[model samples]
Target: MNKKRLGPCVTFFPQPTTLVSTIAADGEVNVMTASWAGIVSKTPPTMAVSLHAGRKSYDNVKQSGEFVVNMVPASLAVEADYCGV
Candidate 1:
């Protein structure tokens, strides 16, 4: 087997798209589409999500210390795309 170098880049196939919902301390609700999330542990049933500091979802999570991750179906692709944007 031969391995070719492909320079530094992030490449992960079929990353699942999820909807993350959060509510701020002021009762402000926000939902954002995220692909940068995955399971980190199985025994404890833990998962991880990545969000930019400037994003509302990040702030909401910080303020509330909670969030909900929802799996998106193929039928809602259009809505998911809109949310991601």
Candidate 2:
């Protein structure tokens, strides 16, 4: 077998996608498709999702300190893509 070195990078092929739903203090609901979410700890059963500061989801999470991470099923691929867009 042949091998080659590559530059520093992060890759999670076939990563599981998720729909993160959040509500603001004003009761405004928002849902965003996230591919950069995953379990960060096992003992504490913690998870993490990456969101930009300027995004509505980020604001909602920050304001309410609550969010739901829903797993994306194959049947909802279209809907998930729509949400991400």
For model 1, how does the per-residue alpha-carbon lDDT over 1-85 read when each residue is reduced to its tens digit? Answer: 8998999998987867789999989887789998788889999998898988999999888888999998888888788888772
For model 1, give the 10-residue run with minimal summed lDDT. Answer: 76-85
lDDT of each: 0.86, 0.86
Question: Model 2, residue 25: what's the lDDT?
Answer: 85
lDDT of 2 by residue, 1-85 (tens): 7887777988567867699999988888888998788889999999988988888999888888889999888888887988872
RMSD of 2: 2.1
Clashing pairs in 2: none
Q: Rate residue 14 of model 2 by lDDT.
A: 85
TM-score per model over all chains: 0.81, 0.82
Q: In model 1, which regions exceed 4 Å deviation?
A: 1-4, 7-9
